[model samples]
Target: RQHSAQTRWVVLNLTGEAKSWTLPEASGATAVLLTTESTPPTINGNALPLRPNEGVILAI
Candidate 1:
């Protein structure tokens, strides 16, 4: 997966198999939909910090 963050947008990009469901969008640098119990945002295969004004980028 991959993502690019902005002031009010967080793009969740998938580099793996497609899922039956799609993730939602984030606004104002806040991502709530990506923070689930089953699937969470990670960095280098490890969990990254969810900060206030920064983005957590993931690569696959």
Candidate 2:
């Protein structure tokens, strides 16, 4: 993940299927789904679906 101080935004790269990470500092922080090769992604046990090749910014 890349965090930009200038934009105050984080860029997360999630690949493959059924992948998850423990982001303690990401609590209450927003997430933007940059890309998806197949199925959508989930954050914090919540379902955040996205279309193929879609760029959707979501609030996690």
Candidate 3:
């Protein structure tokens, strides 16, 4: 638990009009990291697998 940070999220500020971004085509990046955490997530809970879809951003 020492090096672990219970981050609710990692974020960047957005200052622009509404538009959809296609990563590789728009930004010319092969991949993007969502967080600084080196270890990837795995299934460990007693629940169904997640269904991927549009990401949600919330204002704190």
lDDT of each: 0.38, 0.55, 0.28
RMSD of each: 11.7, 6.1, 14.2
- Summarize candidate 2's per-residue lDDT along 1-60 as a digit string, tens digits: 986544234555567774454445745455544455546666566555765565556544
Q: List candidate 1 stretches off by more than 4 Å.
A: 1-10, 13-46
lDDT (0-100) at residue 17 of candidate 1? 34
TM-score of each: 0.22, 0.51, 0.19
Q: How many pairs of residues collide in each model?
A: 0, 0, 0
Q: Write down the RMSD of candidate 3 (Cα, Å).
A: 14.2
Model 3, 7: alpha-carbon shift in Å? 26
Residue 20 lDDT in model 3? 24
Query: Model 2, poorest ten-residue lDDT window?
Result: 4-13
TM-score of 1: 0.22
Comparing 1 with 3 on lDDT, the higher-scoring candidate is 1
**Model 1 residue 28 lDDT score:** 44
